[model samples]
Target: MAVSAGTVMPAAADTDPRGYLKIMKAQEMWKVADGTGITVAVIDSGVKLVPGLRSESVLPGVSFMEPPLEHPDQQYPPHDDFVGHGTTMTAAIVGDGSAGGPQGLAPGAKVMPIRTSIGTPMAFAAIGESAKGVRYAADNGAKIINLSIGGWWSLDKIRSAVEYAQSKGVLVFVAMGNEGDGNESANPIAALPGVFGVGAVDLTGEPLPSSSYGHATDLAAFGSKVQLRCTDNKGWCVADGGTSYATSLASASAALVWSAHPDWTANQVARVLIQTAGAPVDGSKRNDWVGYGVVRPRMVLLDRAGDPGAPDVDPLAAPAPAKTPTPSADQTSAAPRRAESAVAESGLSWQWPALGAVVAVSLGLGITVLVKRRRR
Candidate 1:
C-alpha cells in the first residue's frame, strides 16, 4: 500500500501529474472502448465507494479489515479507507461519473474490490490469506488482478499465489516498491517471478527516486502530483505520487486493451505494453529504474501495434529461463568485493543489520576431500 505525500510536498504537488489531463489522448487510444460486461479484480485495501465517481460501476466487496475482530459487519459493509491510496486507485480504474474529476481509463469496466491491505508488515496469517484472495477472484471470473503492495522481505504465499493466478489466465500487476533504495532492498511481490513489476515517473517524464528499481521492473507510468477523487469522498481530492499509484494506472491501461480485444490472452496484453511503452532509454534497452518503459495504454489499443500470438501461453508464464539472462564475464567464479563499511553507506541512521550473510569460503564442506577418498 502507498502513503500519501500531501504534507511532505508543496501544495501544488497535489495537482495532476503527467502534466495535463490527457483525457483526449486516453480516449483516442481506447478507440475500441467497451467494458460494459468485464469484471476486474482490485485486491488492495478496502475501497470506499465514493458517490461522485459512480457507485454503480462497483460490485459489493468483502472486507477482512473492519473488525468486531472475528465477524464482519454484514449490513453497512466495510469498504472505508484510511490511507486514501486504494480508494484513489479504484476511482482511477473504474470511475464512470460525469462529475468531472479523474475519470477512469476504462469507465465501463466493473470493479470487484477485495481488501488485502492490512497493517504494515502484514500478519503472516494475512499474507497467507491474501494469496487465497487472488485464488478466489480467479475461481470466480475476474480477468485481471492488480497487486499494488510490496515489502522489504518476501512472503512465500504471494509468490505461489502469483503463479496460481497466471495458471488460471489472470493477468497480475504489482508495484515494485517505493523504497527508492535501488539494489539495497528487494521488494517482494514485485520481485516475485510471475508479477509484472511497475516503477514511477514524474510529470516531466523523469523517474522518481522514490520508485523501486530493478531488472524485476517490467514497466513504469506517471506517478507524480496526480489528481484524483478522495477515496473516502471527503469532498476533496488528493495527489498521487507513488509507485502504488503507478500500478493502478498500468492496471487500468491493461483493462482498456483487454476490453477492446476480448479474444486476446494476458500474455498478448503484456506484450503490447512491453513493446510500445515509452521510456526514453538508449537503444530500446531497459533500465534499473523504468524497466521496459512507461506504459502507453492508448498505443496498444489504437495503433494496433502489439502482437497477440499464442493465446495458450501466459506472457510471463515461465520463470526466466536458466542461463538465459545475460551475465558478467566472471559471474560463475568471482567473489564479490566486500563493502567498504558494514554501515551500508546510508545516512538514514540504519545500523548494520544483525543478520548479515558474509560468505567466507568458495566451497562448502571441502568437496575435494570426498573426491580424494573415493579415488583412494
Candidate 2:
C-alpha cells in the first residue's frame, strides 16, 4: 500500500517553522492566484473531514475497495481515512490552517478524496482499481489529480486510465519512489508518457538522498522533514522524507497556476512548470537526479517568467514511443475504453476476476514494506 506545508516569514511565527511559504514565495504568488475554482483529486487511503479542512473544501468521493464479504453492498463514506495518510494529503492540498492546522499551498482550491486500499490485505488489487478512480476524477471535473502511491507492477488498466485523463486535459502528478536510488522508471505508471513524475527535496532545496531519480523523474518539490497535520487529530507529523509530499505540493502548485490561467491546456501548464523549475548549481545541465528541477510556482505566478508553450506541444518527450502496457498477473479485465457508457453506468467495469484472491494471498507483506518505506 502507498500513502502520503506552511509558511511564512518574520521568524517562523506561523505554524510551519520550515518557512516553505517564504521559501516558495507562496504568499506573493497567492496575491495573484489562490487556486480559486480549481478542484484536485487526491487518490490515497481516504480523506476524513477535519477542522483543518474548510467546510466546502471537500466533495463527496467514491471508493474502489470491495466491501467485506459479509456485506457486499456496504459502502464506506469517502471522508473516512483508514490510515491517516489520505487525510494528510488532502489537507496539504486544500487545508485552511484553522485552529492551528497546517495550511495548504492552494488554500482556495477544493479536493475530492478517493480512497483505495492502503496497508490492507487487498492493497495491490486496490491499486489496480486505481484506473477507475483516475477516470472518475477526470470525468467529475477535476483539473488536477494527485497520486501519492506507486508500485512496481505495470498494469494496463493504470496506464490507460492515465492516458484517458490526459486526453481529457487533466494534469496528473505521480510520486517517484523514495528508495534513495533514481531509477524511478521501476514503477510503471511513473514511466508513462505525459504523466508528471515528482521527486523529493530537502528544505535547503537540495535533492534528498532518499528521493529516487531517473528518466521518469520529471520534477522535484519539498518532501523532507515537511510538517503535515493528520485529519484524525494526530496534530502535526513530520515526514522523515519521501516523494509523496513532493507530489502533493506539485499538484497544488499546478492548481494555483491553472486557476490563474483557466484557459490554458494541460500541456501548456506543464510546459510552464518545467520551464520555470529551479535548477541546481550547474543549471544548464539536465540529469536523472532531478528532471528539469525543483518546482517554483512563484516563477509563474509572481515573477511571470513561465511561458505557456504551444498549446498542443508536450513539455516532456515520451521516454520512448508509447508502448502498450501489459496487464500484470493481478489484472484480468481489459482497460476501459470509450463507447462504454453502459459499463461506466454499471460501475463494475474495472473489476478483475481473481484480484481479490491475489491481493489476499500475496500482496500484504510486500505492500506493507512499501508503505513503511514511503513513510520513511
Candidate 3:
C-alpha cells in the first residue's frame, strides 16, 4: 500500500516524533519491558536496512520472489525493499531512531524480514509464496508473525500455514483491510481462526472510516496520521489511515507482553490482551467495528491489569457470543458505566470528531491491492 506519488509529502524536521506512541503511552511502558528477547517476523515486500533500523535488530531473512528475466543478477534480497511498505512496517516494530528517524515501540525486539511479492503485479501470484514465508518464520525461531498484507479471497494453503504457525506456538497479527464503510469484504487471512485481526483507530478512539469491519476484527490501534520512515521519503511519511500500521503496533504490543512474561504461552498472552483492552464505546461485549476495544498495553504494563487465563485455552478460538439484551440492572447499568470509565481510564476519549482533510497515504500492501487466489 505504497502512497501514490501525488500524495507524498515532506516530513517535518522533528526526530522520531510518533504521536501514536504518546497516545498509547509506549514510552512509559518501555521502562518496564521493551520487548527484549522477542523476535517478530515481518512478512511483507522486504525490509531495507534503513538508518532507522539497526543491523542487529534485523536478522538474516529469506525472500520468495523469483529473479526477473531482465535482471539475471538481481536476486531480490530480503533486506532490499523497493516499495518501502515493508520497511515502514519493520520500522514501526523495531526501529532504533537513528539519523532522526522514527523509533519503534519494541526497540529491544528483533525483526525477521520474510519478503514476498507484495504491492506489485506479481502480488496475486505470490499468495503461495507468502504462505511458505509464514511457515518459514514460524519454524525459524520467530515468536510472533506480523502480516501487513491481505486480500479478499481465502486460500487453503494460507489457512493451513496459519494453523501450522499456531500449532508451533506462534502469534500471528494481520491487517483487517482498509475497505471503508459499505464494503463488506473481509481480508481472508485475517478472518482465519487463531489470527489476531487488527483495525485502525484515531487518537480519539474512533474507528477510521476506511477500516474494514467484521467479526474478524479483534482489536483497534492508532493508525491514522502515524509517522514512520519509508522509501517514499528520505525522512518520514505520515500515513493518514491504514490497518497495516495498526497490525504492526499490535504485534509490537504482543512482543512487549511476551518479553515481560517469557514463560507465558501464546494463548495466555492473547487472553491478557483481550481482557485488558479498553471497552467498546457502546458498552456491548464487543463490536464488529472495533472488536473488544482499542489496544491499551499500558493497562497491562503500568497498572498490572488483565488476568492471564488458562494457559492452554485460547480466548479468540471461538467467535464471541452475540450480545444478548438482558433485563438485569447490574448487566445494563454497571457494565456500561464501567465500560465508559474503562475507556477514559485507558486514555481513549469517546468524543468523536470530524477527521480533517489531509493527503491520505497507503502505507502497506493490504490497503491498495486485492489478490484473489485462483481456484483449481
Off by over 4 Å in 2: 1-18, 181-186, 229-233, 283-285, 318-376
lDDT (0 to 1) per candidate = 0.56, 0.64, 0.68
TM of each candidate vs. truth: 0.74, 0.78, 0.82
Candidates' RMSD to native? 11.0, 11.9, 7.7
Q: Per-residue lDDT of 1-376 in model 2, one digit per residue for the tens?
A: 2232222122123345335666777778889998999999998777777677876888888888757677778776777865566776777778786644457889899898887775454676565767888999999999999887776453578888988898898998887766543222323456677788777666565566556555566677777554454323355554442677778888988998998999999888998888777754443334454566777787788878888978876777533322223334343132211111111000000001122223421212233222111100
Q: Candidate 3, residues 1-376: lDDT per residue as tens digits?
A: 3232124344464332476677677778999999999999998878888777898899999998755567757778898776666787788888886654557889999999998766444565455777898899999999999887765333688899988998899998888776644343346677778788787776666666677666676777767665554343346655453677778888888999999889999888888888888777676777766667777777788889988888777788654557333225443322112222222211111111111132121223352233222111
When sorted by lDDT, best at the front, the candidate numbers are 3, 2, 1
Pick out the ten consecutive residues of candidate 1 with the lowest summed lDDT: 344-353
Tell me how candidate 3 scores on lDDT: 0.68
Q: Select the stronger candidate by lDDT from 1 and 3.
A: 3
Error of 2 at 261 (Å): 0.7
| lDDT top scorer | 3
Candidate 3 clashing pairs, residues 3+ apart or interchain: 1-364, 1-365
